[model samples]
Target: MGWPPASAAAAAAILCLGLLASAWAASAAAAAHGPRALAAVQPQPTTHGGLGPRSRHHRHAYAAMMYMGTPRDYEFYVAVRVMMRSLAKLGADADRVLIASADVPSDWVRAMREEDGMRVVIVENLRNPYEGNLGGMNRRFKLTLNKLYAWSLVDYERVVMIDSDNIFLHNTDELFQCGQFCAVFINPCYFHTGLFVLQPSMEVFKSMLHDLEIGRDNSDGADQGFLVGCFPDLLDKPLFHPPENGTKLNGTYRLPLGYQMDASYYYLKLHWHVPCGPNSVITFPSAPWFKPWYWWSWPILPLGLSWHKQRWDDLGYAAEIPVVLIELLMYIAIIAITRLARPQMTKLCYNRRPEKQGALVQGLIKLAAILAMVAAYTIPFFIIPCTVHPIIGWSLYLFGVLAFSSAVINAFLLPPLAVLTAWLGMVGMLFVMAYPWYHDGIARILVVVAYAFCSAPFLWASLVRVIDSLQTMLERDPYFPRLSEPAQETEFSKLF
Candidate 1:
C-alpha cells in the first residue's frame, strides 16, 4: 500500500535526522580523545626490523609534517597517507615518519601508524616568527614552520622531509646517501622546500630557532623562505652524485631537478623528460586550490590521476566512503521530501505574508532570496570532502546543488530554468576546462576564457529573468487567501 503524505514525510524526516546523527557520531568518535591528552602522547619509535643489517646501524626516514590551521586539513591527511603508503609499496628500506601537530585527531594518528606503517611523532605546533608580517599566500604557511621539526628527529640519521602534495614515481632511497643538507633547485637560485634531505641534529634545530628569534631575512615567512635564508649558499654547492660504494656524503649539496619534478613541467612537454638524477617524485607547487588530491584537479592537472591511482592501490578511500554515502542519502531524502510536499509548503509559506508590506521590506526580502540562491550553489562546494574520486565528487556536488536550489525555487516560486542557469554555466565551464585534447596549459586556459566570454551574456539574461520573476511575485495577488477570508483550494493546490 502507498503511504500517506504526512507519514512519508515523517519517515523521511526521521531518516534525515538519523543520518545526521550518524555523521555527528562518527566525527565525535574520531575526536573522543581530548586534544591536550593526544598532544601529550609520546612519539612512537620504529621497531619494525625487517630491513636487513642496514636498519640496525644506519637509520634513515622519509618524513612529512601535518598541522591543522585550514579547512583542508583532512584532505592533506589523506594525501599524506597515500604518499606514505606509496613509499612503503616501493619497498624502500627506510622508515616512514609523520611529524603531526598534537591537535591532529588521535584516530588519524592511529590509522597512520597501525595501517600505513608510519611512525608518529606528535609535536606542538611551531610558532611562526613571521606571522604578523605575512600577507596573502604567506598567511597559509604560518604553521608550515613546523616542518623544522624534521631536524629534531634524532632517532634517524638521515631524514628526507617532503610535502604531502608529492607523488612517488619511484623509491627515493638514494636521497638518504646525500649530505647534511641537500635540496633540489627547481628554480635557478632558491631550492624548493617541497622535498629536501637533512641530517638530524638538535644543534642545527636550535640554531634555526635562534634565526627565527633574530628575525632572519625570510622572504615569504614560510619554511621555504626561512630555510632559504639559512642555507643561502646551497645553490652554489656541488651537485650530489650518489656513490656506487654507498658512502654517505657530508656538507650541503644541490640535488638534481629530477628528485623534485614540478608537475607543471609535464604540461609543457606531456612527458617526463627530466634528464638529471631520477624522476622519482612529482610535486604540486602550483595554486593551492588545485592540489592533486582535490577531485576537480584531475583532468586539468592530468598527473592528479597518478596520485589517485596510488591512493586506489595503497590507501583505499574506504574511510571516506561512508560519510559521502550518508551525505548522498541525506541529499536524496531532502530532494524527495521537498518535491512531495511542495504544494502544501508553498501555500503555508505564502499565507503568512502581510498583504501591504512596504517596498523596503519587499526589497530586503528579494535581496535575501537572491543571497539564499547564491549560498545554495557555493556552500555545498566547500562542504563536500575534497579527495573523493572525480566522478563521485562531481555527482555529490550536483546532487547537493540541486537539492538546495530546489528549495530556493519552491520557496520563491520562481522558474526552475532561470534559477538553474548558474549551475548549468558552472558545469559548462568545467567541461571546457577538462577537455583533454589541449596542446598545452595555455591552450586550455584560452578555451576556458573563450567559453566564459560566450556564456556571460546568457548568464546575465538569466539573472535579469530571475529578478523580473521576483518582481512579478511581489506585484501579483497572493496565492493563498488572507486569514479574514474563507480558505479555498486554488488550481495549484488542486493539481497537487
Candidate 2:
C-alpha cells in the first residue's frame, strides 16, 4: 500500500509540471506579441459576449464614429457612451458599434468594450479630398469623411449611422427593416445625416473611395455633402414604412421627418408635435456650440435636460467628479490664499515715481491692466472641462473668476467692485438665459439681446471706472507702500 501511494504522488507532480509549462508558454507568447495577443486569448465575461469570429449571417448594428481631431473630443466621447448606454438600456436588439480612429487610446477602447458593452472597430482616419477646396466649410468636418467607414462595416445587414448629438427617445430597431439606405429630411431639400440607415457593402464603400480619389463633386467637403452627392435621388424615393412582417426593403427610401425631429421644433411648441411618424429620436443639428451634452446648453435649450437625464441614469458622472473636485479645491485654495495674503501680494507692485513715466507709457500700463482683468475672466472659462455638470461647471467658473479677479485687485490696488463687474454681469446673463417663462426660443433670444443692450452702458461705465482708478493709483506719490513701512490695513484687507 505504501509503494502504490508513492507512485501516485509522483504522477501528480508530473501533471503539475506539465500544466505549469503550458501556462509559461502562453505567457511567453503574450509577452512577445503584446496586449493584442493577450486580448485575443482572454476569455471575456459572459455578459459582454466574446469578440470571436462573428457569424456570416446577417446582423444589425447601431454605429457611431469617434475621431480625435477636435478639442472637445473627450466631451464627445462622454456623449457617445451615454448614447450607446441608452441604446443598450432600450433593449434594442442590435450590436452597439463604435468606429473609432486608430489613434484612440487602448484604454478607452478597452473601457468601451468591457464597461459599455460596445464593439469597437479601429480604422484609419479617412483623408478629405476637399481639404484644399474648403473655403467656407467647417474645418471640424475634415475628419468627418472617416464616416464613410460605416459602409466598410460589411458584417452588419443594416447599420444605423448616427451622430453623437442624438438622444434616443425610443427604440429605433425598426429602422433596420426599412431599406438599404434611408434618411430623414430635417431640412426641406437636403436629408439630415445626423441619423441614417445604410446596408453595408464593400463594393459600395470602394466606389465611394474611388469617387473621393477622383475628386467627385462634393459640395461641403464633409460626409454629408459627399453622401448627398452619392444619393442625389433620395429626395424622390418613396417613404419608408416598416413592414409588419419584418421583411427588409431593398431600395433607398425617405425616413419620416419624425425620425429626426429637430430639437428646435420642441422649442416652438414647448413639446413634441411631430405627427409624421414615430418620434423615436431627437437631433441637435443646430449650431455646434449648442450640442445637448454641454452643461451651458441646458435651460437655453430645454431639451438639453433630457440628454443630461439620460447621462445621469445610464453613465453617471463618476469619471468627471474627481477632476471637478480637484479643480474646485484648487480654486478654493486660490481664493483663501489671495484673501489672507493680500498685503504681501500688494507689496509686490511697482513703486516708480509718477514723473519718471511718460503719458503714453502710463496709458499703455492702464490698458494692459484692463486686458489682464479681461484675461482673468475669459481664461478660466476656456480652461474648465466643457461637459461637466452645470452646477459644478458654473460653481467652478464663479470661483475661478473670483480667485483671478482677487489677484488682479491686490496687484493693481483697483476697487474690487469695478474689477468684479464682469463676473457679476456673467451671473446676471446666465439668469437671463435661464428664465423659464419665455414664449419661444426667438423670444428668449430677443430678451437676451435686449438685456445685453441694456447692460452695455453699465459695463462701459465699469470699464471707465477701472481705468480712472488705475490712473489715480499709478500717479500717487508712492505707487505702492514700502515693505519696510508698517502695513496699513485698508477696507479691502479688513473685508478679507
Candidate 3:
C-alpha cells in the first residue's frame, strides 16, 4: 500500500514536469517565428537617399563658428571632448568652420588636429573677448568684432555664426535654400544671437563692427544689442523669424548644445524667447516637473528607467542595479499604500457638512491651489536646507494656507478691489524681507516692515471682507444707510 501511494505521487510529478517542458518548447518556437514575422513586415531603407521626389532639402549652407574664447577654466576638458564627440557623430563633409576669440587650449588644439582630424580652423582674435561686462551693448560690440573676424576668414560665401554653446545636430546646409542674402537662425533670445547666416557684406559688417557700442536698456546681452538697433536700419536685409514650432524634423534634440561650455542657461533663453533663427532644441531639457517630454537629445539612461528620471546621466556616476531596483520597489510600495489609504481617508473626511459634488469641486480647487504653491515655491526651496528645515517649512506652509484662504474669501466678495490690495500686500511682504537698502536706518525700517507685513495680511483680509459686506448691504438694502430719502440722495450726489 505504501509503495502504491509513493509511485502514484512520483508519476504525477513527472507528468507535470513533462507538460511544463512542452509548454516551454512551444513558447520558444513562437518567439522564434515572431521576429521573422516582424522582419517581413518592416520596410528596408531605400538606396536613393533623402533626395527623393519629396526631398525636404532646399539648399546647401555652412556656419562660421567664431566662438574661440577660452573655455571656463574648470569646464574646458569635458566640454571640449563632448563637442569633439558630437562633431565626430555628425560625420565628415559637414560645412563647419571653428574660430577662436583667444589662445585655444593646448589639448583642444591637439584634438582639433589629431583626434578629430576633421577640418576645424582655430583663428586668434584682435582683442580680449572676455574683457568687460558683456551683458547688453558691450556684448553686442564684442559679437560684431567676433563675427567680422570670423566671416572675413570663412571661405564659404554665406554662413552662420554660432556661439560655442550652439552645437550641430544635423548638416544644416538646407538653411541656405531661401535664396535670400540674410540667413535666418533659431534665435536663442527674443531678439537674436550671433548664431545666424548672412551673405558676407562688407558694408553691413563694416558699419556694425565700427559703431557697435552700449545702448539704454543697457542692452548688453552681447552684440545682439547692436543687431536689434541695426535690423531696422538694414530693413532691406531679409530677416526671417522662424515659425513657433521651431525645428522639429531635423532630429535636432541630440545636437550638441555647446561645443565649449555647458549651455543649460542658453536653453532657457531659447525656451522663453523665440529668436529670429529656426533652431531646434537647447542645452537644457526645459519642461518643468509636471509634463512628460521626449527631448531626443539626452544622455543615455540606464535600462528600464523613465527618461526624465534618468536625466541624472550628467552626474557622470552610474547608479548600481540593486539601488535602482530598491528605489523602484519603494516607489511601487508607496503608490500601493497611497492608493489603498486614499479612499479610506476620503470616506472619513466625506459627508461632513457639504454635499459630495460641492465638496469634491472645492477640494479639487483647493488641491490645485496647494499644488501650484508647492510646485512654484516649496519644491525649489526644498533643494537647499535653509528654507527647507521643519520649522521654516511648517511656518511658510501654514502662512500660505492662511493667506490663500483669506485671498479666496476676499475674491468672492470685493473681487476687483480686493485682488489689487492682496497683490500689493504680497509684493510688500516679499520686499520687506528680501530687499536690501544697505543703511542702518533702512535696516531698522526693514525689520519693522517685516513685522508689520507678517501681521497685516490677515488683518487686511478681514477688514476688506467687512467693507465688502457693508457695501453689499448698502447696494441691496437702502434702509441700511437710509440713502433713499430725497434730501440725502441729493446731498450724496453733490458730495460725489
Estimate TM-scores for all models. Answer: 0.81, 0.81, 0.34
Rank candidates, lDDT, best first: 1, 2, 3
Query: Model 2: per-residue lDDT, tens digit, 1-496?
Result: 1112333443344334333433443344233222221132222223121234663343999999987756566677888999999998899899988887766767778889889988887766777888876665455778898788888787788999999988888898999998889999988888989999999887898898899899999877788889999999999999999999999999999999888999888877666768779988989887889898887786677777778888888777775565565556655665665566555444443445446677887888788788768767875565455676676677777877887677678657888898888788888998898787877777888888998998888889888999888888666554244545555667664543
| Residue lDDT tens for model 1, 50-104 | 1222323438999999987675677888889998888888888988888877678
Candidate 3 Cα RMSD after full superposition onto the native fold (Å): 25.6
- Selected candidate, larger TM-score, 1 vs 3: 1
* Backbone collisions counted per model: 0, 0, 22
Number of backbone clashes in candidate 1 = 0
Q: Which stretches of candidate 2 lie over 4 Å from their true place?
A: 1-52, 55-58, 135-139, 344-350, 479-496
The lDDT per prediction is: 0.77, 0.75, 0.36
Regions of candidate 3 where Cα sits further than 4 Å from its true position: 1-88, 118-124, 127-145, 167-170, 178-190, 201-207, 212-218, 233-496
Question: Which lDDT tens digits does candidate 3 get at residues 152-174?
Answer: 53234444555433344444443
